[model samples]
Target: MSLRLHTLVHACAVVLAAGCLGATLWNGIAERGIALAFGVLVAVGELTRHNGPRVRQTAPLAAAGALAYALLGEAGGRPTHHDAAQIVTVVLAGSLLGSVPHVGRGPGPARDHLARRTLTVGFVAVCFQPLYARGTFDDWGGSAHALLLLALLSLSTLCDAVLAAALAHSRTGWPFPPVLRDELRALPGIGAAVVATGAVMALGVAVVGLWALPLLSVPLLLAQLSYRRYAAVRATYRQTITSLARATEIAGCTPAGHARRVAELSQSVGRDLGLTEPELTVLEYAALMHDIGQLSLVDPVPVGATAALPVPEQRRIALLGGAVVRQTGVDPRVAGIVERQADPHREQPLAARIVRVVNAYDEKSRTGGPGGPLTALEELRLGAGEYAPQVVESLARVLSRETRERDGLTRPGAG
Candidate 1:
């Protein structure tokens, strides 16, 4: 399922639990009803086809269910201390489950980082809640006590999610699944949630008594500042990458242009693989500069010799390409791609994979010396599994169209 849907479902669960807990306390509904409902929901989710990782990934939402059960038990006339302890236990359990790791295309590193934050916050809640209450809630009304606890837990969760997401973004350059980045980029919503929850709770406790606000606010503010600084750095890096990519296009403007065709064709393949705009920019620069290392390739044969140089020349080209990218301050992830292209046997990075595919086609098309387009196709087929499959397919399509156009066998737009 989409990450948006997943997060929305969790948010809904929190709200619904709050409403049910409120109703049970005020109207004296059997607290068992809320407990049963939550139990059924958890059981259904567990028995569903989802794997362990997804269930664990979403365990934070289960805390809402836990809160509801505790509130209901107290409202149904159970002892206050008993239900509060249950609430603390269940919330901690839920937080622990969230800390369990999951595997997927969604950024696992970022998720693990967030999970650690949640666990830390959960621990704080378990340790501090009892001290904060100091047995004062034993005789308090069930409704008021439940509201206070719910507000505190929600605020704590918000703090963890906000801080974790910001730190993860700085480290991973985006949140897991991309949608999370968009959500995190809208961090004012998190701030509003904290402020609103605190404001509502302040009606009972003095605004000054909400010590969690000021304590958590400092970290949240720092996270926001860090996120902004990272964004600024990324923006400047993006401009440099774009300028370099455009510079490659200007290097040679003949009919068989250098970087533009490679970039356009590389982008077409990258699009097929669901890469983002920023990823495309990185791919373009990497592709355009793939041959920068070739500038260092020296002819093994003397000027009088007509024989082509050996594989060592290709190795030299790849090494030079890596040097150029490193000099430009490209991220290690991108630089690794340029460097690995030297050894075709090595796993090529996605960016380099695309560049290599198009570069081969362009070389064959321009040289047109021996096997022509067929020679290029054969070379790609030989390295099929070594290259990204989608990139190879894009090269084939581009070549077929170019050939058909040349032979008057197809129109410009014909595929």
Candidate 2:
């Protein structure tokens, strides 16, 4: 089926299910209306969610989940203590239904992804119950209550980030600090939208009661659209860089697909070494452009010739490339990485270190100068000072995993 038609049909189904569920569960228009709004927001979030560069998918439902919990907390007939079962039921159902579009992609991964989201929302609900029972915001005016709600929502977000970072580290062998750093960095971009959505939901509940909840959909949907646009722009930027990178390869300055392969390998090593997504991004871009300086030479470095260059010549190429990249208004950090690729032993940024090792490995592997992947890895290991021991080891792990996957061999702990 066409994607648009499928999306439309799926949305209609979700809306219908939400309306029926809300109507069956709550007699009041306010309660049912809020439930419907929550359902739609969840569906929109699911449909629009984007996969990030580092294999992490943003959880777009946090704001919607907060709104739903707030609505339940403020409903007129609710008791002092909220019902855990009801919160779980509403959240799990909405999340599961919303995730239907993703199920076919990979059943296990999709289910795991949905479960994590459900648990996060459920945890937020549990956390809010005490505040709800106390009617913490009831006495406060709209502005005052909204501030309190924002504070509570921020706390919940922090908890979620921490939990997610921990899970990523455990599951993917990613390091804790970098994962946490990335999560924290992400907050300012999306957090404002989430805070606004929660505030609107709270205000709506305060003013018009449950009826105001459906109106919350407007802002929530806008936020989702904004995220979608941002993701598209990011994808475009990556593609543009990729295209530029290919230019060097086409010019015979590097081997075919050399930049892309280096980028992939560098990114893998960066991830295993616990670099933040931003760091990994810079690393990948630097790797892709590492040979760009060769374009300046009357006789460009031959494909796979970089590994054979003298140290001074290599440094000269890197410096020229760094200068060229700097002219393009790219991140100075990225330029620094390209410049430092020639001096792998120097104390440089973690990302630069990653590029150095992976770039060298790709060059060696391409030429098959000494041996193949195994020989390349040994050369990197021998230059432990030039390449960080951890980075070399990370590269080794990356290669091992790739080999196993290619050979269709299951590692001991792999599922």
Candidate 3:
């Protein structure tokens, strides 16, 4: 199903792009100067785009330029004549041309990104160009024009977000609602800037002509640069946390890669349980350092199997981990989760409950084991009275899917 859906997404984009290119060839070109200007703006945007892991919108400037072109009605008080097909063609050309240099140097836009970009621009152009060409928006002058552009861009932005989430879900088999929730959560940030800049560029072009393109683009460029810096800072912070999490292993208090395995499994379960993005982050950080407290232990629990230790010892280690987390200036919630992972399920927050269950599962399956994964899971289930029943179930489901995926019993992108 995901395979077909994934193909359908790309197929739709290919069809739209083909139609636009064919139409443009038949219709020749209109307002070549304007098209070239916006095309260059888009290409420049792509060249300067941020490629950070956490970046939601990588090419904000390209998006704004294309959207502005879609909503364009007049330039320098003269009615511009470019249509939907021309708008899509120009943007597509710009995207391809801009990606050329990045071919061997770095990662270019993926198939999904291009598909999303093409479809989004096509959507905006289809809605606006025909309406303006028909003179339906003739009376929409001044504030009416600005408001209409804003409304159109807002709707287009929402559609792009939905498409992005849908494509991601199809390609990765992640649950849709959580992915959609994250996209919607980003709407107020770079999404807003994209919409506002697109609309403002359209308005600016109408009054001040094509010269408005470069001048109106300054704010978004600055915002993009600032966001890149922020992404760098965030990446550095996460690296620092990861290095810290490895301390137990470095000191031989825990098995090599134990923290990483637990963190990965915990995050997978957290997503399966429908934790939001920020909640998942806290869960991951807490899971990675869940064993940091073992560094404080006088003697490491054999194989770092804190899960087999007495409750008091586990609690002591958890408290010590929390203290260490606090001293590192991490998020307070992360510290809290680390601190409370040893508490009873009902008394603990969901993140803490997740860490506790997944940690035990990893320890059991890896070392304190006989039947391996199945045996470890059985043990965790029997002790669900201590672990949250819901979290344990989520862990089981995540592990089951992972097992099938690993064994190739399930198809790629099958959840």
**Whose lDDT is greatest here?**
3
| lDDT tens digits by residue: candidate 2, 327-401 | 977789888888987775657777877877888888777667556778888988998766788888989988886
Better of 2 and 3 by lDDT: 3
Candidate No. with top TM-score: 3
Clashing pairs in 1: 293-321
Alpha-carbon deviation at 134 in model 2, angstroms: 7.9
TM-score of 2: 0.78
C-alpha lDDT of residue 283 in model 2: 85
Each prediction's Cα RMSD? 14.9, 7.5, 2.4
Q: If ranked by lDDT, best first, what sequence of candidates would result?
A: 3, 2, 1
Better of 1 and 3 by lDDT: 3
Over 4 Å off in model 3, which ranges? 1-3, 368-371, 403-415
Please list all clashing residue pairs in model 2, or write none if there are none: none
Q: Which stretches of candidate 1 lie over 4 Å from their true place?
A: 1-223, 253-288, 294-314, 346-351, 358-415
The lowest-lDDT stretch of 10 consecutive residues in candidate 3 is 406-415
Question: What TM-score number comes out for model 1?
Answer: 0.38
Q: Using Cα atoms with residue i matched to residue i, what is each candidate's TM-score against the true structure?
A: 0.38, 0.78, 0.94
